[model samples]
Target: MSETTEKDLYAVLGASPSDPVQELRRRYQQLALQYHPDRLGNECSSEAESGVKKFLEVDAAWRLLSDQSTRRQYDLQRRARELKQDWPVDSTVCLDDMTWDEDDCVYTHSCRCGGRFSITEEELEEETQRKQEDVGEKEKEEEQHREAVVCCDTCSLSVYVIKDVKS
Candidate 1:
């Protein structure tokens, strides 16, 4: 019923958007360290509270986006937001993937695509494995080609092209 802006978690954490997972965690730790209330003195209670709030937000965002399933749900939410931005007149599409966990204050997506058209995390992993196997096979073929040289008799020129093309 209500909508919120899909924030860039990296922006929240004040880190580079393109940072790797390790880098992201490191950045979040650094920022969290800076905002930690234990380090704050009595002189700046308001500032400390604000910092803590921001740090919590950053940490929460990072936690959500770091995990595969949660990140996917967030991504879907972000895509929906982008669509809304592009077409202001269009009604909001219900992406009922997220369900709030009361204690954690985080949303857990109930990733049910319905009927036989479901795309589960297991399916994604299988697909990824398939792709990796395909890549490995292609790489092996390339390595074999690299070891063997092809010389053109007409030009007396030898060239090694990794890309197999029908000429």
Candidate 2:
């Protein structure tokens, strides 16, 4: 739902991240009805096709953002991803130095700036999958090195979450 997200779920629902849950639900309901394929009738028109696509996207976005935990995870990932691209995330650190939060599935390292640098397990898993897809079976014999850049929650400092994955 944040501005940094590649696919802005908020924009899909015509809502913002700051909007209350009730407001989001209301907006979702309105959009659902407006774009419902049934409402568009049985006509095989371009409008109907567009409506169906929008309706599916709206539903998918709501599914991800409706849950409090999922939304938090999404927001965290989006913020970190955007910051990685814009901020000076030149510092590197291994995952062994970070503290793990089991409930949130996040790894955090305390920054000297009185903030925490965090990265989610989901982001790390995705990176692993992407690496697997990019390399051939022969390349899998070698160790995998991955890096996810994350920014401090309280300041502008960023770090590369570098880790080596065994084959």
Candidate 3:
């Protein structure tokens, strides 16, 4: 999920990743008690419904954070996601905007830093294959899409390449 639109489990329980287990448990208990559906009464009021949702979120947060292995995995994945999103994109260029080197089987775009940003046709094909292999049998989704980031050969600048599936 996109970071901006995605919900943060830590924020759900008013806890941080670095917080101690005791602190997390304390925050989780506080939130659980505050949002427990049982305390909201029998009436199907909007507040009660919202409380139920909050309670479920709190419970889920606790489930992931309470386990040592699961917590480590979650932290690693979150860090990778943040690192992926933190990179600065020098520009966004379409695959067609690049010059194709038929001999090298690579597409190249000129960077403002005077370094070349290049991606090979084989690399793109390999990425598509990797994504296809990653699809689960239970997931019947048919759409296939992936991003190809091309970094400058001589500089830290990177270009976001948008490859046209038809191109």
| Top candidate, metric lDDT | 2
TM-score of 2: 0.50
lDDT of 1: 0.50
lDDT of 3: 0.77
Comparing 2 and 3 on lDDT, the stronger one? 2
Per-residue error (Å), model 3, residue 102: 39
Off by over 4 Å in 2: 1-5, 86-167
**Alpha carbon lDDT of each predicted model:** 0.50, 0.80, 0.77
Winner on TM-score (1 vs 2): 2
Mind giving the per-residue lDDT tens digits that candidate 3 earns over 1-167? 23322567788878888998899999999998899988888979888898998898888888888888988888887775664574688788878879998888889988777889989877766655554555655442553444566779999998877765642
Model 1 regions lying over 4 Å from their true place: 1-6, 16-18, 42-44, 86-167
Ranking by lDDT: 2, 3, 1
TM-score of each: 0.44, 0.50, 0.51
How many clashing residue pairs appear in each of the predictions shown? 0, 0, 0
Best by TM-score: 3
